[model samples]
Target: MNAPDIIDFGERLLVPHVIKGETQISAEVEHFSRATQETVMTPKLDLDALVWRRHEVGPAFDTPLAEIIDFLDAVSEALDYDKNSYLQEAMEQNARIGTLGARILENCYRDIATFFTREAATAEAVGSFGSLEALDGWHRQSIRGAETDIRAFPPRMVHILAGNAPVVPPITIVRAALSKGLHLLKMPSNDMFTATALLRTMADVGPDHPVTRSFSAAYWRGGDEAVEGHIFRSQYYDKLAVWGGDAAVRHAMKYAAPGFEIISFDPKVSIGLIGKEAHESEESLANVAERAAADVLAFNQDACACARFQFVEGDDEQIDAFCSALQSEMGKNTRYGDGPNGPVPPQEAVEELDMLDMLAPLYHVYGKPNGGGMVIRSSEPVGFNPSGKIINVVQVNELSEALPHVTVATQTVGVYPQSRMGGLRDALSSSGVQRIVRLGNHIGGAFGGLPHDGGWPLHRMMHWVSAEV
Candidate 1:
């Protein structure tokens, strides 16, 4: 892979440029961060120019929906990991700016194309609007006394992308194309290159295409009031699609007014619920352990969907055995993780475990901080966040007893014994859990037209306009 002009100076990293629509914005503005002590040089953003004019927005909205799909298909071809230059650049620079390892990051980048498909694109429109015809043009519907024609129009949006998952860039790009919206992506500090790399790939496919010209990706510090104060108003952008991080979402909320709406994918937690049936036999216990391990190993527990907390129904001896089995199973290979011994837990988590170990009978720690997965069987929930293949298992009298821990911040709950889900799903949903899945199947499809972070974002990204005659 031929690397870009990005320079790493041990202390300071220089990102070569930013993407402004089909144009490449060079290093014109230098930003210094006192927090990270890193200086970033990118093109100066013309805050006024970021907003699309009435005439420019019209061309994008009028572009045939099929044409936009074709453009996205071409983009999918450009993301091929074996041949795409942009992804190659991403693979090279990801280590300095990303959280995942080289092998895991490559696996994610390769799957980028799957996120863009006719089925996936149209499905989001259908799922959001009941029919694809709503996005193509006005669809007339018969009413009791009056006939109404309704259509979905794209809104001008600013996508604040979180870099936790590498595939987010393509997801945002496909959604923007499908909705036919004007997008200005504010790149996060962790993984800044992928989004700009994607826009550059689109420009290569069709530089003058309306879709390509309707997109831009750049970077500024997240809370820079000077830049955000000007661009976040309703006059400049209609929607703010903020992803990940509590601070990012809170800062974006300050700009949300009556006309400007914030579509937030806030930070969330996921947990696993195991039934006593798992202990029906040694084999049943082993199977449950394997499934629980896979959920914890997802992105080494960095992803929101990865199970960090677990509630189990078993006696003290049985629960202790399950923890040991779970830690052992996590050492084996899974789709999201490879080799033996998973990543080590974060330092703070390890310190908390160490402090808890002194409590003896009240708390038990399985597996060490060195790696290979760790489980903290606690009488109550731990305070520190769980990460790096760590799972906190709390024994519960019944699965529903764990309901109090489930809140609006809970994104997914993986329950054991498929039949148990039928009993717990309603209560789980009412308690603010958006998704409930079979114990071993916590990871699901990422395509649109699906429930995400509690709402349908594609539907939120559009302006539902109606006319009556």
Candidate 2:
């Protein structure tokens, strides 16, 4: 059957001008206010046509960096929650995450401004390439009496977006533009609207502009060989920037070769560390519990950097008191306005906790099993992944005991008592943790200066070409 021509672009649903692939198929994708079934006609894979479009549009994005910043400023204003139809549509289609609060949407919008700053971009360019001159044009530098002119060239990139956070699409778009790449984005099934909406906004900035023309966004079943096989070829795309779980990362890795590179933002877990000061006074304990709650419930704990397990150095009574306070804090709305995702925990998660409660003497349960914020106190880390607002509070004699659990997969560690960070930061970094932040701060918010997965992405995304004189 021929698929329907009309496609949902989050806010503005319309018919696509170009289609690829021969097979016509329908997919059940989430839509604003309802679940809708839709059809897609696959246009035949044309590597030459795609490459032509990339070269045609690449020059448009090769403008001055200030122009790009101005374009992004317009996008940021367009994304304002009160006025943005696409964002409104996003809030509706992604009800599972959007319903958490208005502040969540606001925060997503706020993150856009952080990326386009001149200071931030310059710092990233310098940090990654060792000089900003490479960004403007080729720069001459001497090494061991040899002179080389280095220029940062934009590569042809494909971005596989993750839907866990709404801010991802805009961030990806900014990176692609900054690197001046011929970019294609594959939106996740859970979030079909965001990338399209942002791209539409970009087109609105300058219709037929190179930055707009150089971009393409589409969706396909992840492992479909008919589509992936053609696009994943080294001759087609220079880099694959992926953000997903282990399976998705592994799938992309299989396609990596000499000329084709895969930069992956893989699945990671976060935890919180509490020092003995948390038990010294009621005020201190209350502060620690509140901070821990912020880390646990941020983005409904769906963000990889959100803390799922907290290790506390305190007695049973002290730990129990903190848990009681944490339970209360999790249910209450914060300044960011997020609360319990739902009243009930996922059945599988509850079952796992219950079995642990029955089989293990070290496990202690707090709050209701039906959610409203639940906590499990244990002597060691729980065997299963904690989700649905369930936090594993493992009691430790010293915060150092939790270091063994800190692997390369650990993304963020929230520590209490600012001074304690001096002692633990080195050990935690040595253990493979990426970020260390004070408890209560949102772990996912970017200041535009932090390294993602240990490196500056834009620097890595570009091909550093050098000529010897």
Candidate 3:
């Protein structure tokens, strides 16, 4: 039987294109509000063929950086949410991600331009290799009685994309293009449409463009040896960029061979730190609470960088006031108006927290316990993961007490009263947190040159080639 056609990026819907191999696998992809049945070709372990294709496409992408940036700008404009049918379909298909809403989706689509700006792209290239000249061509440097030439060469890359945010795939695409790497993206089940839509935009930009030919996006169940075993071999891909939960990270780690490397963006949690000054005046208290609410509800608290717990330096009454204000803020629309307003907490999570409220002296529950945004006041961090805008407000005499709870799993620490950040930064950095930002700005809207999870991803993704003479 002929394989069913899946959504290929506006190129063609031919069954032969959909299934590249003789053997085919059929599956149903759940698009939240709807489900679509599709078929994927079982991968043929042709390492030599894949590598040759990458090398063939490499020189074409070695165009001037300015031209590449211009191409990306055009792609970004094509992705604008105003009248893009592809983006609309992607938003609908990705709706099952739950935390995403129309406003958030629009922002994600619009932000693609930010990643590929001339300033950002230039900064990334320079930050990665020390100079754009190094990436454009080999640069010579003299050593003791010797000369060495070095260039930043693009590698054959396999990106195991995370489904947490729609922007992730586009960011990865920009990195791959800037580095001139041949990229094969493995789409997550929860977000199958984003990569396709972005790739389709690239196709629209130029069907025969080297950057277009160098890219391919497809889906297969992760850990399916029939697929991953063949592609994960070091002969085909030089690097595997894995972004997902612990299980996914661990699975990708197994495929890292001697010559090949794995760059893992593992699961992480975030928290907020409010100073005691928040309790000194009504205005201060209100400001801190609003900022805390922004951190907690950023991306509807679904982002790994979004703060889930707030450690406020205050007494009982002060803590109560902050919680009251937080509950109100969580329910109301914010600057990104009318987006997702926190999901309903799962019954198991609510039930577990309810039991804790009864037994634990530190636990004080506020808002609707079942869902619709709940805040728990506690003397220490709660054991369960707080979801659906359920924030744990831990009251402490001093902010230092909260440091013990900041473990290796912590990703970002949003702090209030900018003065306290200087003192707390070193401690938080040592505790395995990656980013520290002002309480209200933890969403990571910066354009580029920022290290994600404590490393420059574009730098790490490329292969640095040096020749000594």
Candidate 4:
């Protein structure tokens, strides 16, 4: 017998319970102290009580595949700038609230909602992405030939929101819903209201939109496995999407069942690359580094895609010059997490930064007197050694060594000479790494609808019925 068209979890699911078994928790709020490699909660969160917070928010189940496509059509239409206003007052609102909020903490949902209104509309910037390019090479692989069967399967996913990067989690929600998945979105305590507000707007776009029945949002602590274990074991969800530190992923993984899969976008690292020739413009390195610094400040060096590491090609002087440039660029945003030009508290972040200081082979030192926000590193190291707060500069005689360190989880690596992009394709083509930007413009940049890391998520939570079409 087929399951009901609509399903609801009647009781308020509090404590550590999982709605559909896939678990996405907020590990972004972790305190990276030297004593503990894992992030300690900065939000003063309540994990134990959230297990039972599940209530009847909306319907969740499979919609006909054709209906799914129609919904996508509606979304496409809404994204149309000519017809829809999109993000007019949104960004200005974002600047206002984000600046006033003083920090992008768990408690800033209202401001985040205002910001999303702006940023989401920034799609208006490039025709609201209607004309935007899809990031993955998967589009080429999505074969539309009649020989290939387009089986619309409803996958299950658990979306863990990242408090550090407010707007990012909603993108995952859109991806899963667009693919016709039954999405169980576990809200990060810090930003629950923000996603809730988004879903509310989505409801406006189309009340009976399939996302209504297919998506559920709530918040719980990252490591609470008692509820997650039961939820994952229920075999209700197929994919798990987590965004945060490695420990958070490990904790969520413990609940993974065999048939049920995991889509973990865990703690990833990103960097920048420059050909030696970039040193010619002198200003070129600094110009690019400043843009890259904006990328780091976008989410306060919290997003996996944040360019925490930099790989540059130059003489000692050139590298030093680049460092100076990055410092000057990064100088603008003194505070972190959507706040105004406030002060960034690095006591916890610096601990990890200091520990990595010994492990990292090279880095330029900044801070002290001038205070937080400085790039550290001379050249790209042979391997990865993360510094939480300080920027680790690795002066590489060659770019080849940095290749091993870049992974699917990496979001963007701004490189120079833009043409060399094709040359490194063979060397850097890995499953987890995403895109390669040219020199600067690393912040607020993208090829829309790209699956971060490797396009390897198909293995998770999919109800595949393979056939030779």
Q: Against the true structure, whose lDDT is highest?
A: 1
Report the backbone clash tally of model 4.
51
Candidate 4 residue lDDT tens string, 1-469: 1111111113211111222322233333433222223232322233332322233232323444345434544544443222322122222223232322333433333223332233332332123223322211112223456444333345656777665555565466545554555676676644433454344445546666656546556554556665576565433555577766777678777766776566677677777776787677867666676666766665556666667787777778887887777766665653343322423545765554565456634544655313336667654452434433346677878776678777766667777668777878666766345667675555455423334455534223345543445
RMSD to native, candidate 2:
5.0
TM-score of every prediction relative to native: 0.92, 0.87, 0.87, 0.66
Note the Cα lDDT for every prediction shown: 0.79, 0.71, 0.71, 0.51
Give one digit per residue, the lDDT tens place, for model 2 in 1-469.
1113344444433322221211122333322321234432333334444443333447544676556656666666665555666555555545432334446755665555455456655555566666645566677999789999977877788888987777678778877777767887887755666676667666655665556766777766687787788777777788899998898899989989998899999899999999989989899888888899888887677778888899999888888898888888888765443565443677988788778778655777787754468889888998888887889999999999999999999988888887899999989999998888888764645545467777789888988889999
Candidate 3 ranges beyond 4 A from true positions: 1-61, 96-99, 335-341, 369-371
Task: Give the TM-score comparing model 3 with the true structure, all chains together.
Answer: 0.87
Cα lDDT of model 3 overall? 0.71
Tens digit of per-residue lDDT, candidate 1, span 190-276: 776788777777777788888887887878888888888888888767899999789888988888899899999889999999999
- Model 3: weakest 10-residue lDDT segment is 14-23
Task: Estimate the TM-score for candidate 1.
Answer: 0.92
Candidate 2 ranges beyond 4 A from true positions:
1-57, 96-107, 110-114, 117-132, 335-338, 341-343, 359-361
Candidate 3: tens digits of C-alpha lDDT, residues 94-153 = 653334676676667666656666677777767666766666767788978789987777
In model 2, the number of clashes is: 6
Residue 179 lDDT, candidate 3, scale 0-100: 81
Best by TM-score: 1
